[model samples]
Target: MSTEKCVVCKGGGTIELLGAQCPFCNGTGEYTKTGESYLKSHICQCIFLDRKTCPLCGKKCHHDTPNKPKILIGPV
Candidate 1:
């Protein structure tokens, strides 16, 4: 397993919020392997906005009609 500091608050795990502590990391600055890697752990919300397809399988669903749903067939 690999260990690394929190990238959100730059290892301090806390962000100044009008003299209040950051709620994201809770001032710990430490995190462990919970399925997500350290490199890809810190991501902004823009990632979701830029995504138009599945990142894992790189598949895009096409909907023929608004009422009909797109079916995805693949191995999980």
Candidate 2:
């Protein structure tokens, strides 16, 4: 199932999901279409950085990426 896009992060904005090493693609900047959809396109490395703070270090973190990739279904 695809995740419901939030109002702010609906249009390919990785601001809501940013991290150093992206979990989904592991910073490869690529993804697969197997059992995926456009709506769930945001399911990537950024998703792992969803938390506002670092759970391990307990430091304040920011999840904003100016160079966010265009999250679409079929291709990059």
Candidate 3:
């Protein structure tokens, strides 16, 4: 986990950045894991525009899921 100044809101943590889920990998960012696959939370929007990702699996976000804060990783 790294903390660089946010490019959008400039670190306000309030700005919403534009992004797309990795379609080829369903936001898993990775092609495959050694054993278990990554997963996202049904209660938390796991995709952030450029910040945190799925800690366990490194997925950005699921494409089929709505791009809402409730599921993605952006601030809510």
Candidate 4:
């Protein structure tokens, strides 16, 4: 286990205002990845501090398209 917080909610386990659980950590504020290959990976802590959505439209945004709002993650 890591002491680091979730990237989406900043350890709150849920998105602010929306009242929805973080899709990344699933509201646990912790991330762990496992695979069949003898290797495991974890998300960087810095990701938590990065902006998740566009400040203008309040929609999910990315650097790839500064003026467009796209679905970063699909339904899971």
lDDT (Cα, tens digit) per residue for candidate 4, span 1-76: 7897655566777767467886667788774342211111222222223456543223444334443333354333
Tens digit per residue, CA lDDT, model 1, 1-76:
2257554445565643234443444666665343135324332222232334433223453223333234443444
Q: Which ten residues in a row have the lowest lDDT in candidate 4?
A: 34-43
Best by TM-score: 4
- State which candidate has the highest lDDT: 4
Per-candidate local distance difference test? 0.40, 0.35, 0.36, 0.47
- Ranked candidates, highest TM-score first: 4, 1, 2, 3
Candidate 2 per-residue C-alpha lDDT over 8-66 given as tens digits, one digit per residue, 9 for 90 to 100: 22323332334244333333334424213433332334425544443322234332345
What lDDT score goes with residue 29 in model 3?
36
Please identify model 3 stretches exceeding 4 Å from their true place.
1-52, 68-76
Off by over 4 Å in 4: 32-76
TM-score of each: 0.30, 0.22, 0.20, 0.40
Model 2 steric clash total: 2
State in Å the error of residue 40, model 1. Answer: 7.6
Worst 10 residues of 1 by lDDT: 41-50
In model 3, the Cα lDDT at residue 39 comes to 33
Q: Please tell me which model should have the higher lDDT, number 1 or number 4.
A: 4
Tell me how far candidate 1 lies from the true structure as C-alpha RMSD in angstroms.
9.5
